[model samples]
Target chain A: MGIALILVSTLAAGVPLRLDLVLPDHARRGKAVPITLRLSNPGPEPATVYLQGRPTAFDIVITRADGTPVWRRLDRAVISSILQVRVLPPGQAIEFTERWSQQDDRGQAVPVGEYRVTGVLPTDPPSELRTQTVRLRILP
Target chain B: MRTPTPVQALAAGTLILAAACSDGNEPTAPSNETPSAAMQGANQGAPDDPIALARGVPGFGGFYLDAAGKPVVYLKSAAHRARAEQALTPFLRSQGLAPSQLRVLPGRYDWTQLEDWFSRASAGVLAIPGAVFVDANEASNRVTIGVQQGSFARIRGIVERLGIPPEAIEFQETMPVRLLATLRGRVRPVVGGLQINFPGFLCTLGFNAVRNGQRSFITNSHCTNHQGGVESTPYYQPSQNIAPARVATEVSDPVYSQSKTGCPPGYRCRFSDASRAAYTSATTSTLGRIAKTAGPNNGSITISGNFNVTAEGSASVGQVVGKVGRTTGWTAGKVTNTCVNVAVSGTNLGQLCQTLVSARSGAGDSGAPVFKGSSNVTLVGILWGGIVNPNGSSTTFVYSPMANIERELGALTTF
Candidate 1:
C-alpha cells in the first residue's frame, strides 16, 4: 500500500460526506498551530473520493476580517504529479492535519488580529467538500 | 482508546531493536536507567524536533507527526529504511521518547537527490521550450518543472531520456518566461524598491548595506555598468535630473566571471550580478524597509507604507516572496527555482545562480528589493531581470539570493 493509503483511507462514491474544520479558538503568534479536517460519511453506503493534487487534498486559507486573504497553503508551488484516492465507510471520519508556522503566505510573522481559517477539501465537482469557517484570534 | 494490533506490536518491537542497534560500536545503555526530568523537559521544547533532526540525516526526505502523534520520517528508498530507523530511533530515545515514536516511511527521492536532479535538468533538459523553471519540492519528494502550453510533450521526451520516473516529475503550465528590463528607475532615508538613476538609465534600489563601516545601497550591477564593462558610476534618487547623491564603488564581477578561478579547488564557485553604491554624505538618510502597497497585484496600487526589514536571509523553493520595484510596485509570488544557472542576453551575465519568482517584473525593476511575505518583511533577494511572457502578461523574475549577494560583495544588510 502507498503512504497515502496508510495515512488516510479513501471514501466511496455517491455517499454523502461532510467536511468539518477543527482548530483552536485562540493561538499565540509565532507558535505552531495545527489545522485538521474531518471527513465523515453520514450515509449508509461507503463512498470513494480522490484526493487530487499533491500528497494531500486539504488547503488552509487565512483571511482578515474584511475577507482579504493573508495566507493560503495551496497558493505555494506544489508537486502535482502524485495523486491520492481514499475510501471511507459509513460513520467513519478520516482526519488530515497540517501545521501552520504562524506566518502568512509569504513566510513572515503574522500580526496579532482576528482571522478566519477555512479548510477546503477539493473534490471533482468542486464545493462538494468544505468545512465551516473557524474563527481564530492571534494573541501577542 | 484503540488497542494495538499484532502488526503494530511487531512494528513497535522493531523500533526498539533498531534503537538498540543504532550505535552498535558504542556501549549499550542499561535497561534500568531512568531519564532525568530536566532532560525530558528540554526534549519537550525541541521545536519541530523530528523534522529538525531528520534534515541532518542523509536519505531523509521529510517528516511529519501522524494522527497518533508518532514522528514519521520519509526515506528515499526502502533499502535505507533500516539505517534511517536505526539512526532516528536512538535520537528519539535520547529525547526521552519511546522508540515506537519514530516511524520510517518510503519516498521516491530525498532532498539531496532531488536537488541533484534539478541541477542537471536546469542545465540540459530544461532548455526545451515551455520549460520555464526547474526546482525541488522536498515536501512531496518530487522535482517540479514549470512549462508553458504546448511544451508538455517535448518536456516528457526529455524527462524520459533523463531516466526520471513520471511520478518523480511534476509539470505545471505557466506563462512564457522573459527578462524584466527597461531604461528606468531609492534610498538611505530614500527607501528600497524605488527609482535609482545611474548614468544613462535607471534601476530599482535593493537595500541599505554596510561593509567595514562604509554605508552603501545595493542594486543590479548591470545598472552601474550597462555595457558589460566594470566602472564606478554616480547614482541619483528620483531621477538623474536631481543632484547626484551616491557613487557606486563596486560593480559586480564582470559577467561570466567564475569564483573557481580565484578560490581553492574544494570551494564552491558562485556568480553575482549585483553592485553597491557608497553614500556621498550629501544625503545622510537611510531606512531598512521596502515600499509596500495596499492592494495585492493591482498595478495601480499606491505605496501605503514601508514594510519593516529586520535582517537578510535566503529563500527556499516553493516559498512565497514579495518584491517592490519601480515598475511593478508591490507584487508577491512563489519561488519556482533556487540555485538556477542562467544567462541574460545583452547583460553578458552567464551561468549565475538565481532565485526565480513567479511574478511579472518590468525592465526598470532590476535591483528591486525582494522581501518575505509578511507584515514584518526580511530581505530575501535582489531582482536582476526576468522573462516576461510574449504577450507581456506574466514574468519569471530572477534574483540573486541575499546570502550569495552578501558573500560576493562582503557586505551585510544593515537594516
Candidate 2:
C-alpha cells in the first residue's frame, strides 16, 4: 500500500515537458545553413529555460555519417550562445527558437551526409542536467 | 622507362589544343560607363570665365541676355508684344474693351514663333499683346500660341477666337529658358535627302506582328529605299536588300572606327554599330515610319531595329519608354498623357500618344524605339518638339503615341 501511494504521488507531481530539436533537414554544400531549437513549456505557470555555455564554448562540430567528428573552433561568435527565454502566461503555450549557422565558425567543407547534433543544458544544482539531440542531412 | 619521343610530346600538347576557343576577342563595356579611350580629350581644363564659353557657343534654343549679363534660359519665349497685338487686336477690338483693361504682354510665346517675333519686336514695337494665341508653327515645327490674363469670360472669348483646342492650350503665364547662354548647334536634319543602307540590319521577319501563319519581315518604311551608294546619311552602302535577313552575331566596337578631332569639350565621338543580316523567312513586321520627315515635306525615312509586329501592348499613363534612333542613338523616357490631340505641323495632322517631357531625345530622335525597358521598343511615338521657350533654358519634349503611329503605318511586317 505504501509503494502504490508513492507511485500515485509521483505521477501526480510529474511535469509533462517536451523539447523538440528543429534544424534544416538539408542544405547545399558551402552554404551557411541554419539550425534551430524548439523549447516547448507545457505547463500552467511560466517556465524559464536557460541554455548553458562554457566560458569558452565557442566551437561547432559537424560529424560525418560514420560518427567521425569534423569540428571548427570559433574565435568570436556573433550572437549570445545562451538563450534565456520565458514561457507564455497561464494555459497559453509558446515556442522558443534560436538559430546558429555554419558561417559562425571557420570549418572545412561539410560533405554530404546524415548526422546528429547534441547540446547540454544545465540546471541549478549542477548535478541535474538536461540534454537535447537533433538529426539532419547535408546536401551536395 | 624509355624517354618519350618528340611526337609523344606533340600528342600531349594536342589535349590542351582540343579545348574550345569560345571566348571572343573583345568583352562587353559597362552599361552606364563611357569608354576610357574618349575620356582623355573630352574634359578640357575649365575656362577662366565660364560665361565666356557660354557666349561663345551661340545662343540657339530659348536663351536671351538679361540686364545682369547672366544668361537666363526660359522654357517658353518671352511674350511677343507685336504677335500678341496681332493676335489680340481682333479680339480686343471686337470685345469693345478699353486698352487699359487689355494689357499687351511683352515676350511670351512658343519658341517656334517666339524667336522670329522676339527679334522683330526687339527692333521696334511699342508693346505687343501677350497671349494673343497665334497658330504659329516655327523653329522646331511646334504649334504654339500665347495666353492673356483678364476676366475669365474675356479670356474664354479670346481662347475661343484663337480656335485652339481646349486641351492644347496651357495657361501657364511664365515660360522658362536656359539660365546660361548655351549653343544648340545645328539641328541635325532627319533626312538630308539621302539614303541609309544597313549592311548589318538585324531582321525580325514579320513573324511577331501577324495573325496565324502570315509572314512578313519587320522593317522600316524609311528602310524601304534611300539614296544611292555611300553618299547617304548613315553612309552605308548595301549590295542589295534581302527579303529576310538571318540573325548576325552581336558585335561591339571598342576602338573608334574614325577619329573626329575638335569635338567640343564636353562631347565625345564613339563608333556606331554597323552590323547587318539577311532573312530567308517572312513574319508580320511591326516597325514602320511613325511620322513624316522632320522637314516641311513628309519624305523622311526611318531606321529600325528588329521588332516583332505583334499587337501593341497596353497603353498606360506614367510608363517608361525607350527608342533607338539613327542619329540620336538610344534614349529612354516616360508617358505623360494618352490620345492627346497635337497639331502636327506640315501635311500630317491629328492627335498622338503624348509623351512626357524627357530630355533624352532631340530633333533627330525621330524613328527611335520608344518603348518600356528591354521589350521590343515597339515604335510608339514620333518626337516632334519639347515645351520650348524663347530664352532656351528648359524645354520639355513631347511625342506622338505609338498606337497612332502603328495604325497609320498599316500592316506590321516582320522579318
Candidate 3:
C-alpha cells in the first residue's frame, strides 16, 4: 500500500492553507449541508488525487463516523466527478473549491453527526499510478 | 546359470513399479547391467558401448516418484545443454539421481532414446512423456502431455508407448525458493496506489530458498510487455491488473451473480439454509484452532475466522479433498457424514466441503494445503477446484487430486 503526502507552503495569500474537515461542526439530523476540504502541495511535484468509490466502480464514497455514507448522488454524477479531474500534476494545489449537497433520491437530507471522506491517488514520484482511497471527516 | 542377483532384482522391481503406476507408456526393463557393463567388467572399457550414449541422454517429464517415494515435479528449466552433460544433469543437480535411477529401452524409438537427452539439468526438468499421435497410417508422432502441473504422471501414456521403465524415472519436490527480488526495495503500493512496473514487473511473489542465494523467481515464458505485478484479490491474476477498479471489477451483485451461476446448467437459483450457516459454528471453532496452528507452519499473519467451507459430508466417500487456490496450498480430506457441502466457490461447484479437524482455506487458500485426517494427517491430496465465483444462494466446488499435485510437486522440488 502507498501513502499520499500533502505539503502546504502557502495559502489564502502566502499563509499555508490548513487541510482539515469542515461540516455540521454540530448540526441537527436531516439537515442538508456541504463539507469543504483545504488542500496544499508543499513539495516541488504537483499532486493528482482521485476519490475512489467503495466495493464497485460506480461508488465513490465519504462515510459518516458511524459508517453511513454521507455523499449521495446517482451513478452518473459520480462518474462525472471522476472524468472532471482525470489529470493533475505535481506541485499544483486546488482549494476548498468544489461544493456537494447531501440528500437522497427523495430530496430528503441525510441524517448525520460526523462524516469522513476518502478516495485514491497516485503518490509515486515520476509515476502516475491511479486509484486510491481519500479519507476525511466532517464534524457538523 | 543363476537366479537374478540382488541388483537385478532391485532393477526389475523398480521397472515394474514405474510401468504399472506411470500415467504413460510402459517400457520393458533393461538388464540390471547393460551389455557394455559386462564388457567394461571384463576389459574395463568397451568399444560398442550403446548403453553409454543411451545413459548419457537426459530424461525429461513431469510427476515422478522421488527418493522418499513421494511424487515430485520440477518447475524450472534451462535453455542450453551440452550433449555429453545432458544425460546426467537432472540427477546430479536436483535429487542427486544417476543414470541407473531411470531405465529406457534400447532399440530406437525406446524410452532410453528420449531419456538420453532430457534427464540431466541442474536447474530442474519437467518430465512428461511426449504425447504420441498415431495416425490412420499408424505413423506415430509425439504429442504433448498435459498435467495440472508438469510431471511424469501427465505423460504416463507417452512413457508406456516409448517403452520406458517407470522405476528409473522419479518425481522431484521443489523446496520453497526466494522470489522477492523485485519486491525487496521497491516502493510499497498504498491500498489503492497504482504504478506501472514503470520499470519492469520481473516477479513479485516471494518464497524462502535453500541452495541458491535468494533471487527473484521469474518465468521467461509467463512474461509479456506489461503483464506483471500483485493484485489485492485472492485469485492469481497477471501482473498488469494490481490496482482496484482500473484492474478487476467486482463481479456485479457478487452475491446474486455468484448464486445464479451455482445453479445447475438449466436450473433456477435456490437459496437454501444448507448454503448458509449450517456449519458456521463448527467452522468458526475449527478456524480459531487452525489459525493458532498456522503460526508454526509459516502461514500469513491474518487468518480470517469467517472463511467458508461446505456442510455436506457423507461417511467414507473417499472424497479427494484439497483447495483450489492461487497461493498454491492444498490438502486432502475425507468424507465426514453429518456434514453439508459449503459454497467453496461463488458458483454451483458444491463439491467443496467443510471438515472439522482439517484446515481453514481462504481466498489465497485456493491451493491451500489439505491432508487426510483418518489416521494421522498424511499428505493425500491437492486443492485444485472450487467455485471461483460464489453467491449467497449456492457456490460450486472443484478440486484436483492431492496424489496428482504431490506427484507433480515431487518432480520439481526434490533438491
Best by lDDT: 1
Which portions of model 2 miss their true places by more than 4 Å? A1-140, B1-311, B345-357, B375-398, B411-415
Which model, 1 or 2, shows the larger lDDT?
1
Best-performing candidate as measured by TM-score: 1
* lDDT (10s digit) by residue, model 2, range B303-334: 22233323345346677654443333344555
The TM-score between candidate 3 and the true structure equals: 0.24
Error of 3 at B353 (Å): 46
The residue-by-residue lDDT of candidate 3 on B12-82, one tens digit each, is 34323434443443332322323333332332212233233223223323223434643232111211122
Model 3, position B270, has a per-residue lDDT of: 18
* Residue range with the least summed lDDT across 10 consecutive positions in model 2 chain B: B181-190
Specify the CAPRI tier of model 2.
Answer: incorrect
Residue by residue across B373-393, what tens digits does model 1's lDDT show? 566787888887665232222
Off by over 4 Å in 1: A1-140, B1-188, B226-230, B243-270, B390-392
What TM-score fits each model?
0.39, 0.23, 0.24
Native contact fraction per model: 0.00, 0.00, 0.00
